[model samples]
Target chain A: MSDTTIKPRIEKAPVLERITTALPIALVPVLAVLGFVAIGDPAAWLTLTVAGLAMGLMIFIMASGLTVVFGLMDVINFGHGAFISVGAFVGFSILIWLGGWTASSSVFLNLAAVFLAILVSMVATGLMGYAFERVIVMPVYGQHLKQILVTMGGLIVAQQLIHVFWGPDEIHVARPESLRGSIVIGEAAIEKYRLVAVGIGVALFLAMRHVLKSTKIGLLVRAGVENGEMVEALGYRIRRLFLIVFMVGSALAGLGGVMWGLYQETITAHMGSEIMVLVFIVVIIGGLGSVEGCFIGALLVGLLSNYTAFLAPKVALVSTIALMVIILMWRPQGLYPVVKAK
Target chain B: MKEPLLTLSGVHTHIGPYHILQGVDLVVPKGGVSVLLGRNGAGKTTTLRTIMGLWQASEGTILFEGQDITKLPTPEISRAGIAFVPEDMGIFTDLTVAENMTLAAARGPLDPDRLEWIKTLFPPIRTFWESSAGTLSGGQKQMLSVARAIIEPRKLILIDEPTKGLAPAIIKAMSDALLELKETDTTILLVEQNFSMASAVGDTVSVMDDGHIVHAGEMAELAGDARMQERLMGLSLEAHQ
Candidate 1:
């Protein structure tokens, strides 16, 4: 026998028992296509599929940070949507103030404005998360009902604050020159702004994955998620960990808000409240705390909403809710749970 | 013979409004398994919890290696060369055996020599090296907990109950492993209800009753004193043996 043949069957059949294992993260795009096909007009299925995928990518980006905080810290932040709205408004203000929605402003200045807007949103929302953790969440650790009540109060306060500053009227955002118009791929015509948003979302997703795997803080997070008391016992200040996670989560939401503003070109005080319903559906369907699950969940919801809207228009609104119920019925813990080691 | 590594004086702990440890006093010399003996709900577990800094000693001082550590957080206390193995073993059930070991090691490389030593001490851990700790038998989980503590350069190890629900044979093995660990100069504060296991591995014994250390002395002295054993532990010499 050859040396290879003499060896024992080292390739033991890979265990298929991880009921919660993430589907290949690469297949998010593929699943998005499948989603569109299931819900879109038969003639325009492919284009709608691509659009739905793009939409999913946006939702995945928005909810990624929220899910990380949820999974790792066990904190369900209701102010996540508020952060997104803040990012959109901040970005919109920068755009309108610079050039009155005209095409003459330096592209560099516009980019800088976007960055500044995102930065403002990030800092504001991050600080909000920090304070929220210190004042409301920390004292009532492991109390779900208290968390729900306090954070809902926070949401109402944040919405009122947004209205106080930006006013109740709907605000308009202009697409950058480079992101204006449409991209024709094969027989598909897609909005250039939506594509750019998808690109940004993909970049952010990659960066989050790298940080979670490579960074010391990330390891601490994984350990903390498994056992907070043990992590605390290992000399880490749990309070600091909680703060850092909250900030990162809020910042991610802020970035998502910027993307959402760029794509829709509209902002309002209720933008957060509007998208929050979708965000919760995404996170809940994905699984309570799994990033992979959130990504998968977001994309599934995004595509479900987009294609269903494209097909039935009015009836499409219930698509996300339906998918959520179906998912819960199948796997009550969420689609891709982080399986407890047993 | 040497200065005590840990000194607890008038340690009091209250969980919320109810006082758990009321004026407990004890001392553990530098290199021995000092067993804290008591019946269930007699504050034996609370005494360990208080020392490990899980519960703040409301009105007492804990000196570890000559530094007061009563006010420090549990993590800081653990980092100050003391490791705690709780009654539940506090094993991260989601982590694999290897991951659990790595988590426990915290900052250091898995010392191969130490791993080999512990593997020799508790062979089942080697056999179940990749298995999740939650799948292990109760005895095996206790071994993993002790193994996790020993993986670090732990100057002091506090094990709440190493043989709480183990069979007689596994308890014997645990006692033998702890005896070997004691030989390596690791100071262990063990809380146990199993008197035979405690007597076999303990260098000194402190009997706790109603949240206070009622009797404390060298294990040899306590073992030799039949009347003292009956009064403190409610066990006659034959029953204790």
Candidate 2:
């Protein structure tokens, strides 16, 4: 270590810019208030809000990986949904095996069973993601049309494989003892699982933020997303960084799949593709490769979907599309757009 | 005789159907600045890029420290101790200045002495230490780009147009920074258009036209002679010779 005294840095706060950045976050609260007013009943609104948040957080988990992958290597893996389905099925198998623990009256045993299933599912999905990147994604780098066609083909094959293993039949699952019922607050009965999901989602969002903002790996990821070529020139192998990110992203999707399957209490081989519509919406709305953007977009879509489904069932079908259109019109590049190299 | 740190022989690069660098030859001497000067589309940027291994030369060899790096992947070329600051500066705007610097140092944490020295060279780096890179002014961004290149010790640096756009004040500061950087004995292959800045820091100069080096000699020779500037800047009939 050499001796050198460095000058201290002076902090300069730019208030206007901070406000501008924070405005998108305010949209969640604004939309929630609108939702509350539109529904006009505290109980119904609260229940729907919890459910919407849970759905949003789950979608954030899934879309988070896609956005980063899209942003970093510019790979459009339509095969991403395959990992989701695989995760759900894997977790479903584990849950079925641990049925006694899940059915047990002890909350500890129930949570322990669910945790084990999630862990096993994450590993299965993470490994599958690694293989998927090497086998399917590696060949189609920078070729948009081929990436779409090949990954979609991969998705189809994965679905077929799922059928081979889990059979083509839709699998139903029962919630664990502690997670089965809803908590009554005043007049509203909020599902315990929904609340738990919201907590996990918020915690995950915070954790992800910390990683992206604090860690060296996260810094490399953020750098890789913006200018991968530059990242390579700086002496780090970006492809390796990108591979790690791809695996982690896939693992996250796997986690999301498990959560989503449990939430719906049903698992189908085609479930991943069916949810792709919402995932794509969140990715597009969040700005490709932006985790924060994905989170907010997920929440907005989830909240709006639930609110619209409650307020106007007919409008709910097109609400997500309309939201995307409106957001695109407003920001064009999506919220929190990554400044790409020209 | 000054030692050659890098040498490119008969380098040619094709991007899709367009030929960017065609039959280019260059040599960067160790321990000082070698400026690659050219007008628009003279393939100065492409030459720097080819040397950095961003774009693989379709034909020919690029030997850095005598190691043939013609077909090496960009990351490996960089890992061989060559840093590149592209024309775009390639700053990750979303990341803070501190984060950008953190990514620059490939091996462990940055050296405190070097960090302090860089802060002295580019004052804006300290001012915007925690600020998002996107928030910086153009001059500050350029400073950050150069600072990033020197964040760690490297044998060679390939910089493309560090003074493309800026006020005279910023250019002077950049010129002063490069002059001071020369004292540390880092080999810099700078692609630039600003003649004054080029003349100020360059120990050796190579003028390019139509993807070929038209003139190569001491920077003083080009700086002292007005006729050479007009002859090589454009309409270099001797490029064939």
Winning candidate number (TM-score): 2
> Model 1 off-target regions past 4 Å?
A1-43, A96-120, A338-342, B106-140, B167-170, B221-231, B234-241
- Extract clashing residue pairs from model 2: A67-A289
Q: Place model 2 in a CAPRI quality band.
A: acceptable
Put down candidate 2 lDDT per residue, A159-247, tens digits, no spaces.
Answer: 99999998999999788989998899999999999998898789989998999888999898888888889998988888888788889
Kindly list the per-residue Cα lDDT of model 1 for residues A1-342, writing each as its tens digit: 011111111122346744235343544576566754574555366666667767777788778777777777776677677778876777677666655333555656656666676777777777777777788678767776777778778778878888898898887787766667777876667787676666776787777767665555665676677677767765668768878988888777777787787777788877877888888888888776677778778777777777778767887879889988988887788876653322
Instruction: Score each candidate by Cα lDDT.
Output: 0.76, 0.88
Clashing pairs in 1: A233-B75
Model 1 agreement with the true structure over B1-241: per-residue lDDT tens digits: 6689999999999998998888998999999789999877779888877888887889989999899999998878988988888898877665567777776776666889888877777777687787767677777788888898888778898898888878777777788788888888799999988777888888888998888888888888887778988888788667745
- Scored by lDDT, model 2 comes in at 0.88
Candidate 1 chain B: minimum summed lDDT over ten consecutive residues — where? Answer: B92-101
